[model samples]
Structures are given as C-alpha cells and as structure tokens.
Target: MREIFEAELQQLGDGLVDMSRLVESAIGRAGTALLEADHQLAQDVIASDHEIDRLERELDERCVHLLAQQAPVATDLRIVITALRISATLERMGDLARHVAEVARGRYPGQAVAPAARDTFVRMHDAAVHVAGRTTELLQTRDVHLAAEVEKDDDALDALHQETFAAMLAPGWTGTPQETIDVTLLGRYYERFGDHAVSVARRITFLVTGDFDSEHAPSHRAEV
Candidate 1:
C-alpha cells in the first residue's frame, strides 16, 4: 500500500511538470503569434488551452484519490495540498496565455501591438518566458536559488509593464485608440502571467519552510 501511494505521488509531480511545460509553450507561442501576426499560430495557442485544463483536472483528481485512500499526514499532506494549489496556478497561467493568444486572433492579419511599443512587448514576453521556465525548474528541483531567480524575473516583468504604460503616455506616441487599448491589455496579460509564476515560487517556499505566515500562504491554502 505504501509503494502504491508513493507511485501516485510521483505521478502527481510528473503531471505538474507537464502542466508547467504546457504553460511555458503557450506563453512563448502566444507571444510569437502576437508579435509576428500569425493568425494560425494564434489559433493553435487558443485551441491548446483545453489540454491544460484537462491536465489540471486529472492532477486534481489524483490528489483527491490520494487524500481519500492514503490519508496523508504531516509533510505528505502538505505535498498533496501544495500540488493542488500549484496545479490551479498553472491552470490560471495557461488561461492568461490563451488570453494573449485571443488578442492576437482578434487582430487577425494585423498585429495586436503597435510598432512603437513592440520592443517593450518583446522585453515583457521574454521576462514572462524566463519566469515560467524558472517556475518549472523550481517545482522539480525545490532549489531556493531557482525560487529567488523567479522573483527576479517577476521584477523584470513589473518594470517592463511600467515602461509599457509610460511609452503609451509619452507625448511622441501616435498610436490609435484601439492600438493603445491593445497595448494596455497585452501588458496586463504578460504582467499577470509573471505574477502567477511568482505565486508558484512562493508555494515552493511554503513547502520548504512549512511557514504559513509567508505572503503566499493565504493563496496556497488547501482544505486538508
């Protein structure tokens, strides 16, 4: 019974890693679709959201089964609960990626971002990708160094988001109202993506320290 329980736990970890990969790919491809104006790529990203959803459901069910059958205690219970929270965070990240893709699709042949703000968006996209990638690594390794790196990556995204808004407010800006709105929404989407990654990093911190007082504790709580 213990052996079977351990196997389920391992499988749950693998599922989370897979889910992280899907989110990373979604953000990267969605950014490409937005920047390059690729309608087909945008459509592909939009359609792939369902897979992320499916994985989240599967992982959640596995956690439930483990809790019901094994009745994990102490650190084991913490692990299972954290897995549920992490899965939910990954799922939300996937949704943000899909939202970015939707912006690209909405613009169709035309690019969602205006030429002037393209560089800013590129920086934001790169930071988002880096954070997501680091988040995946942190989940697998539980390395505090990676967790710190994720926080740094999120800082970069925040800075880039501010710059994005600053550029829009500049007197030299010439983009239409529609383009301005697109830039605003896209900036928010990318920023929110980084925020979700940061949340996962915090969960890992909670896992390591078992400190519920951490800033992320409120969001990471599980009924069990």
Candidate 2:
C-alpha cells in the first residue's frame, strides 16, 4: 500500500508540474503577442483554452482517484488537496492569459501601447513571467519559504500595473484612446497573473502548516 501510494503521489506531482509549465507558456506567449501585436500568436493563445481545460479535468480526476484509492491521511491528504487547488489556479492563470490574447486581437489594426510607455508594459509582462515561473518551481519543491516571496514579487507587478494606469491618465498616452485601454487591460492581466501565483504559494503554505494566517500575505522570508 505504501509503495502504491508513493507512486500515485509521484504521478500527481508530475501532472502538477506539467500543468504549471503549460500555464506559464500560455501566459508568456500571450504577453508577447500583446506587446508585439502578433495576430497569429494571439489566436494561438485563444485556441489554447481547450488544452488548459483538458489539463484541469485530468488533474481533477487524478486527484479524486488518489483520494478514493489511496485514502490519503494527514500530509498526504494535504498534498492531494493542494494539488487540486493548484489545478484550479493554473486554469485561472490560463484564462487570464487568454484574456490578454483577446485584447491583442481586439486592438488589431492599431498600436497596442503608447510608444513612450511600451517599455514599462514590456517590463511588467516580463516580471509576470518570471514570477509565474518561480512560483511554479516553488510548488514542485514544496518550498513554503520560497512561496512566501510571491507577495513581494506581486508588489513589484503592482508597481508596473500602476505605471500603466499612470500612463493612461497622462495626456500624451490618452491621445491614443484605444491603445491606452488595451495597455491598461493588459497590465491588469499581468497583475492578476502575479496575484494567482501568490495564491498558489499560500496554498502551499497551508498544505504544510494545515493552518493559515488571517492576512496570509507574503512574508519577508517567503521572498527567499
């Protein structure tokens, strides 16, 4: 029974890792498509919803099977439950990425961002990709301390998001009304990606402690 359980757990872990990678890829591509106004890339992202949904269903079924067959107790149960939550988080992240892609397509035939403020949006997208990648790695390692760093990383994303807002309100940027909206919305998608990564980190923390802080915001040590 022990061996069987371990094998199932390993399978679950692998599935989670695979899902995280797919989600990260989708997000990164979507961000790039938006910034570059690559219509085909944007369509690819929109088409990826089916893949994300399939993974979510597979992960959910696997988690359920583990719960029923393995009868996981204590930490094992925690691990399984966290995996379930992670599946949902990754699914949501994929959805946000799709939203970014949709915005890109909608803004076709026009600039996606203001010329002067493009650099800031690009930085925000890059930061979001980095945050998603790190948090996914943290999940695989079950590194609670590292997970905690996510909130601060999200804080950085928030700064970039604010810059988008600031630029939109600036007279120069608002001149391109459509581009201004797309930039603001794209910033929102990136911010939400960071927020979702933070949620995954919190889920990991909960799995370990079986306890949660009221605020549960990322701590100084979490950044590590």
lDDT of each: 0.89, 0.80
After superposition, the stretches of candidate 2 with alpha carbons farther than 4 Å from their true spots are 209-211, 214-224
Candidate 1 matches the true fold with a TM-score of: 0.93
Roughly what TM-score does model 2 have, to 2 decimal places?
Answer: 0.88
Worst 10-residue stretch by lDDT in candidate 2? 215-224
Per-model TM-score versus the true fold? 0.93, 0.88
Candidate 1 local lDDT, 1-224, one digit each (tens): 88998899889989999999999999999999999999999999999999999999999999999999999998999999999999999999999999999999999888889888999998888898899899889888878679789878888888888898899999989999999999999988888888788788988888887866663455321111
**lDDT measured at residue 69 in model 1 versus the true structure, 0 to 100:** 95
Stretches of candidate 1 above 4 Å error? 215-224
Using lDDT, give the best candidate's number. 1
What's the lDDT for residue 115 in model 2? 80
Clash totals for all candidate models: 0, 3
lDDT (tens digit, per residue) of candidate 2 on 123-142: 88888788878877876898
